[model samples]
Target: MDVARDRGAVAIDRDECKGCGLCVEACPPRVLRLSAELNRYGYHPAEYLGSGCTACGICYYVCPEPGGITVLRRQVA
Candidate 1:
């Protein structure tokens, strides 16, 4: 695969998220969005939509809850 074309993966801990939508708005790729389903916390969690994730970690940085979102960047070696 072309290193430049590599896409990253995003993992969100729905149970911890408060659905603040900070990460969703901060996402440059527009890959993140509020889910239709409610989490155990009764808040609609952020879900990853089909898009090119650059693994910029903007979502992780903007998240209020610690470790609520995890981003795995595709490293080119």
Candidate 2:
């Protein structure tokens, strides 16, 4: 099985997100996407694609909603 190598990870807060798509657009690796399913607020929330993240925190900075996005960088051994 082939696994995608990721330098970082993203965590999206579904409830906090307003489906603005800013983070998705700002993502450098294009690893973020809007969910097909609507959130409780009847909006499509942003989600992480599980790979290709560079942990640049662009998503977090671009997101208008506080706590909507969290970027985690991989620890160097």
Best by lDDT: 2
Alpha-carbon local distance difference test for all models: 0.87, 0.89
lDDT of 2 at 14: 97
The model with the greatest TM-score is 2
Candidate 1 lDDT over 1-77, as tens digits, reads 34357478788988998899999999997889999999998999998775578899999999989989999887777
Candidate 2 steric clashes: 0
Per-residue CA lDDT of model 2 for 1-77, tens digit only, reads 11246778999989989999999899887999999989999999999987788889989999998899989998887
Model 2 stretches astray by more than 4 angstroms: 1-4
Q: State, as a TM-score between 0 and 1, how close model 2 is to the true structure.
A: 0.92
Clashes of each: 0, 0
For each candidate in turn, the TM-score is 0.86, 0.92
Worst 10 residues of 2 by lDDT: 1-10
In TM-score terms, candidate 1 sits at 0.86
